[model samples]
Target chain A: MIIAVASGKGGTGKTTVAVNLARSLAGPVHLFDCDVEEPNANLFLHGAVERTDEVTLPVPAVDAAKCNGCNECGRLCQYHAIASFGSQALVFSELCHGCGGCMLVCPRGAITETPRRIGVLETARSGDITIVTGRIDVGVAFAPPLIRAVKGRIGSGVTAILDAPPGTSCPVIATVTGADAVILVTEPTPFGLHDLTLAVETVRELGVPFGVVVNRVGMGDGRVHAYCAKEGIPVLLDIPDDRRIAEAYSSGRLLVEALPEYRTLFTGLWQAVGELAAKKGRATEVAR
Target chain B: MKIACTTTGNGLQSPVDPRFGRAQRLIIVDTDTDAFTVVDNAAGAAAAQGAGIQAAEAVVRAGAVALISGHIGPKAFRALRASGVKMYTTDAPTVEEAVKRFKAGSLTEAKSADVNGHW
Candidate 1:
């Protein structure tokens, strides 16, 4: 079972819920931090580095010697990463999406793909739990490609928990696309409610089964709960506003580790997720 | 020598657009003959990414050796620089005024991108 923890707005406790859940779950559980822009799950789940891999994208390099300026590559390229103006083609590798469309359309066969390093992926082991983290190099504009690289490390038959990046953009979509169930983490504030609506729409559009985990529940208004109730969305867990939890988070401590009493709460969350996923799986099977 | 000025309208009297990559239109002027033609930049203006690069290519395609605009972004500057096109920053109100300033060497040559990428 794959469970992706996501939030539409930043600073909504996605990493908090994801790390704690990974710690509470029994058996083999792999946690993949798909937030390549700024991965922070390793700060809480420190482990021995087992493997490292560099992430790269294939960007085009043009050869001027064999070139006739046909302008076909420029017209075909939507991003305008490469263009020819009655002369040699100009290639801006940073703007390239690695689609290879230009190479295919190049009649002179002058364009060749070259690997450009974009980020790094690391696999670390914390006790029995495996943590895979991806961090994109600075000035790299996109994150979905790197996020996909992180998701590639998932081992089969292991319960996987993905810590997704914030916002309902391409990065978030890339993280949550294949999950069995997604945990939409949000606080009870107005901002949370607004972005939760967007996230709910995103998950619904993707036809994925999801539930809400209200973090810092006591501080904000009840509109989040009310919105969930009106939409028939399940509220799986409610973590109250507690200074001890904040302090634990500040010191890079997992909630289950810092406050052993809350282990049951997270364990129960896993149970609820399992039941919901199982039910949805059966429903999908029946539909198919 | 041909010069391209990012503009908001089609004619010489049109105000010079502050943006380089996402400018509304580009007015190319032949400094020798005083003849000018307007090139619509709707495609670059609506581009999701690399608008500056596309706009710079458009200017190069028009055979403009120099560009006059309010602010040039890094990517646009790189693209223009690769084509050996000089970029100039202008505070002139109209396209005609910008061209006059360019001809008189009153406009400041942009040694580097005045603004960061994605501006």
Candidate 2:
């Protein structure tokens, strides 16, 4: 089963939940940190990454010598990153979407695509679990490509747990899309509740089966639980405000390692996710 | 030269908001002659697929030589710059105030918005 762990707000223990769940879950597991911008799961897991791959994007390089300034490349580009008119063409690398439209429309074949290094994908093994992650280079505008690279490393027969980035944006979509189920981790505060609402809407729109995991549960108000109940979304697991868990997190330690008792809780969480996926299959069959 | 002032809503001299993608209106002003025309940007929302480029094209088609706004992203900036339109960035709260600042030569070219935060 492919289960995606996501959060609406940053620093809400989404990674903590994901890492621990992978550690506790039985059978072969692949833990993919799809949060390419800043992947922190490696920091907590003590393991050797066996493989790494570079992720690149195709960027247009204009050869100005052979080009007549037809401006067709510019007109064809939806991004407007290129402009060719009156014997001069300028290309902005930052705004280039790597669509290759400019090269396709270039009458002189002056635009050639060159690989621009955007990020790297790393794969590591920790006993039974295989962790694959993407790390985007600083100053790169896109994350979806890197996120896809990480997800592509999934091997067969492994229960994949994807740790998605925060918020309802492109990166988040790339991580959660096509997963069997999603576990949205959120706190109980107003900001958490507000962003969770947006995230709920996003996942619902995608028609994915999802449940809520309330982290730092006792610290904030009980409004998150209230909202979940009202919306008919199940609160799958609740990790209370514990000082030991906080310390373990700050020192780059998995919660299951620090607190072995939490392993059973995570195992139960995984079971619950499996149940949800089974229910989704039944519902889809009934609809069909 | 007619200039487009990025605005929060579709009206004459509306407040010049910072958000480019969510801006409700693209207020077109004749900087040279002091005439006004408001273009509704309700159809072209920000960060949506192809919306930023479309909005830039709409502004350029309106014959605006320049764009005045609080912040512009790399995508929108590239779209406008490719069309030979200059952009003046400022934190002015109102469109009228921004035009006044532009006329007085007080507004400076805006930079890309900070992408670090959870916006």
Candidates in order have lDDT scores of 0.91, 0.82
For candidate 2, list the clashing residue pairs, or say none: B21-B46, B89-B110
Q: What would the per-residue lDDT of candidate 2 be over residues A1-288, giving only the tens digit for each residue?
A: 789999889988899999999888766788999988889888888769898889988888888786776879868776656765334466766567788898888888898998888988898988888889899999788899888888888766568999999999899999999888999999999999998999999999888899999999889898999999999999999998999999999999889989887888898998889988887788779999
| Predicted structure with the largest TM-score when compared to the true one | 1
Model 1 chain A lowest lDDT segment of ten = A84-93
DockQ of 1: 0.52
RMSD, each candidate, Å? 2.4, 6.3
Q: Per-residue lDDT for A42-160 in model 1, tens only?
A: 89999788999999999888898977878789899887789875567888788888999999999989999999999999999997789999999999988988999999888787799
Off by over 4 Å in 1: B8-15, B46-48, B61-63, B81-86, B89-94, B104-115
Candidate 2 chain B: minimum summed lDDT over ten consecutive residues — where? B110-119
TM-score of chain B, per candidate?
0.98, 0.84
Per-residue lDDT of model 2, residues B10-77, tens digit only: 65557896755446778889877778888877766644443555567677779888888766766566
Which residue runs of candidate 2 sit more than 4 Å off their true CA positions?
A286-288, B1-119
